[model samples]
Target chain A: MTSEKKIRVLAAKPGLDGHDRGVKVICRALRDAGMEVIYTGLRQTPQQIVKTAVEEDVDVIALSILSGAHNELLPKVAGLLKEQQAEQISLLAGGIIPDSDIPYLKKKGIKEVFGPGTSMNTVIDYIKNYCAR
Target chain B: MDCLCRKISEEKERWVKTTLNKAKCDRRTDENGEDIKVLYTPDDICAIDYLSAIGFPGEYPYTRGVHASMYRGQPWTIRQYSGFATPEETNQRYKYLLKQGQTGLSVAFDLPTQIGYDSDDPMSEGEVGKVGVSVDSLEDMEIIFRDIPLDRMSTSMTINAPAAVLLAMYIAIAKKQGIPSTKLRGTIQNDILKEYTVRGTYIFPPRPSIRLITDIFAFCKDHVPQWNTINVAGYHMREAGCTAVQEIAFSFSNAIAYIEAGIKAGLAVDSFAPRISWIFNTGSRIFEEVAKYRAARRVWAELLKNRFGAKDQRSWMLRYHTQTSGVSLAAQQPENNIVRVAYQALAAVLSGPQSLAACSYDEALALPTEKSVRMSLRTQQIIAHETGVTDTVDPLAGSYYVEYLTNEMAVKINKEIAKIDEMGGAVDAIEKGYIQKEIEERAYIIQKEIDEKKRIVVGVNEYLVDEKVDQALFRVDKKVARQQAAKLKKLKKNRDGQKVQLALEAIRRAAEGNDNMMPLLIEAVNAYATLGEICNTMKCVFGEYRASGWSGR
Candidate 1:
């Protein structure tokens, strides 16, 4: 393993989804991949997550929301990232996103969407490829 | 023909020599240090005693199960955990669940209610009804179970930190219904120790928290004999990234601590041990998950009888509830969650849980919509009715592979328990961040395996396809917060202010003295003192617990 600059990721659970098994698993997967990950516990607001993303200067912001407020919440986070001029940070999201919402999320600048059954390798590959690009 | 033959031969050779070869490999170690054996065999379980280890269901040590008839007697209760928005809305949901043939009601309170913040508290802003049902006062609790009979239906409230307050409120509601407190049958997830390690919704330090728990245990034994004062949980810890063995070890350690605390408070083991229950998370690993449950029962029985010197068989038996793993559900291909949940539920039933909560298929995307929740309940219904898995108790009991794994699991878990005891128990381990760090490390390793493609998660990294489907997702109304805040304000306006003050002061005095806080808390709940107000009063006296090391800098 190269001792290169580790790809830093902010794994955040926005809104009030107290069910966090998927998020915890993903967080572990990313950390094991040798990426520097900051887990901001649970019940974070979209604004709080964006604020943390900016403060941590993370290379990617991964939002884990199973709370069905993704349509309202994801756009807000994307908007705040732009307003804060942190658009360089790739936005990735996981949790149950309906198929119809993927294009909408993509339109809002979420570079990749890793849904259930998406292997950790795919996420790691997507981040590595997207970040390099 | 020659060119086609050559290409075909090359493809066939590659599949036969490499792909098939790799597929047959055994015992691959994942990043989390978990061994993924190709297949478990009788040889793997050489140490198990057929009669002793895989005992008849509902027998001593309860390795196979606690009930000999198991699900055939009565299929595990289908208990769905749901609460959202305001008490009125939650009441509607509860009524709907009861109508859907759900055997028991499991309530989920919002963060504000859990942390003892009033609906109008600054921290409660924008989060009043986002996650769970919001209960600001006894008025809210009265409305939550409004027309429902507390005497008829068993309820499980998934609340900690403010668990005693909520329990007191339930008791007050029961008293108002002319039902003696002793007749109520329900459970409070008074598992505060797990909160610090995994769930993170804690109010006071370990000492005062354990005191609060012991107070409830002591009071319940004498008063609400039918009520379960605490549900020692490994569900959150497993969801938080612990291995199956670690989950059992950590949760049992927590249970031991609670027992020690109760004994210290001058209570006998049999007085409340039967009422002490467990909640575990059933995951994707079908056999491993089943083995974990069976192993848990055996470990608990040994610990209670041998270690604690308990004479009562009821004190030795481990009764538990199982919830499908929320962590295994994915955001993509959300429908796949249905199959995953079915497997988890099946594991729980076959492993022999007292009750099971199947997670909704839409859980990965949002709070479950009515349709999704129904489907979840239906999944359990199908297993109970259509499948003959329930016809036999511990159907997989005699399998050499299962018995061996159960024994191996017990040994591994006992080792961890010894480590925790050396560290002065679960509370001490949690305080020192040992448990938290270990879980985080394990979580990291599991993820690493997936990142490297060592673990195959269908629809996520492999067998990929670009397809999308629309799912009905639940959205919390923005109006929920405003409505809840208004109700809190109105309750404050109408309730007797002086009685509330006296009740609060009584609670403070009880906290200082050796008196149990339940009776005073019941009085406060009856006076319509808001949950936040009661918690704030306790916080002032007890102070909030911050992990000694986590400055977050």
Candidate 2:
């Protein structure tokens, strides 16, 4: 069931959060795992992230936010993707997110939430499994 | 001495040849990838003269420590970096911390404030008071320090890019409190070079950013003599995942650029060099971190005295503040981070810094609760009062491994600094994305090592834990954003609009021309103009900076 096409993903940092260490690391790891990663750089608003994802036609949007703005921002991005009819793209998140906030993020359409100490392998595998399914 | 050295070298060679196994000889790299030998004796640091190279504390080439008495004179200040939510809440927290025996104040402005955006700005959505206090005008600053006396408290604000505006607000508040500028003692993290590389709060481009920094240097020299105009920080760089040696080299290179910029701005080297402080990150690799600090002091002294020709004794000293690394903390076994923080803080103390902040154990997850922050401050207090390690100055000065590592670290750090110098300096290197690429490569490797289990992180990679722990994490109230916006609205309604317009115009004129900006900034803040107004006035002239993204190439 291995697909011939490489997975296209967009890594976005939303809401004025500039802790890019996690996002950049995930981007590099995604690229290394044979997926195309387009980093939106630091400080992209939710609208900008959705617009870029829809325009670039990415298969997935991975949002990273270390600043505690995820509660408001993650849902906004999900809502925007739904409004744009781009719900096919899987959404993921990682950063200094507390465990208590994970359920809310998942309910808001984030497929999975990765906290600190998550291995790159786990992320790559999740993407592969999701694509295969 | 030469004959004795030869005899010892021969004896060491003979011992290695007879006793060492192949496995021991095959491994030559230390944790940070530096080459290391099996043993170290007098032969390793034989070339470093004791007096000229590794001199006494408070002397030239201060390899041991900066002050003669060190902690014996006075313990390093317990300066925990804290601020969250509205100005009133942060003010309450400040009072609580001071009552809990915190000595100095280190303010952390929210991201919008750091980037010069008002709470109501579209760019500030969902971000006001998220990470730190949101200050839109002098009114917010007044609330942040409502009852705290400016003259008695030594404050350090972690603000860059818009550091000038924040300092002006601080001075304006002090004036309202009837305190003169001379009585103000504090530091502003005005180091913008790293912003282009790692921190990412930069506003203006490199040339104009350096211009603003130099303006502060000159302004502080004449007006606020006691204020530390800039804290040349490598802490953020290290947190973004550079090695200890790279941290020292890169930060020192940035310092060199600032010194050069100040001299070019028609100021004497010694006049502004003494007020340039530093911020560094200390990690859990105890010996290496300690050696890194020692080598950093020696190399900085040599650079200031010999290269920059700074004549003042104060100019030769490398006074720094150290913070325990937050990246080293793991969320799985949150309690383990306490031990990690303790070890890292011990390393910073052993190396002799002017101030220290131990990261709370719960910071790996979210904002630390009051209980965790109290534990963090208690960690520093324990090291200062309980641990006997601070009984003397530079206790591990003459150890063979520590000295060898310190000397070797200096050589490696100098080599890296030379590479950056050849690229024309920190600004040029950052412009070319050279520094960013180097840091990414190191950071990637570090993460890869942890992933592949080459490096073992307790309770993360090695030990398996299957437990759900419910802990109360401090969450900034979402109401903070609305409240801050309302405050800004009320202030805009009450303030003298014409006077604000006039002050902002003056700022714009000064920013466009070759003029010192501090006096004009103070005037603008006193007129009750918002931070966004002042920064936007300059932004029209300086323009915003968009970094050429590093795609990990």
CAPRI accuracy category, model 1: incorrect
RMSD of 2: 1.6
Docking class of 2: medium
> When only chain A is evaluated, what TM-score does every model earn?
0.95, 0.96
Model 2 agreement with the true structure over A16-95: per-residue lDDT tens digits: 88788888888999998888888888888899899999998888899999999998999999999999999999999989
Cα lDDT tens digits for candidate 2, B397-421: 8888999999989999999999999
Per-residue lDDT for B132-180 in model 1, tens only?
Answer: 8888888888899999998998999999999999999999998888889
Give the worst 10-residue stretch by lDDT in candidate 1 chain B: B544-553
Q: List residue ranges in candidate 2 displaced over 4 A.
A: A1-3, B22-28, B550-553
Q: Ten residues in a row with the worst lDDT in model 2 chain B?
A: B544-553
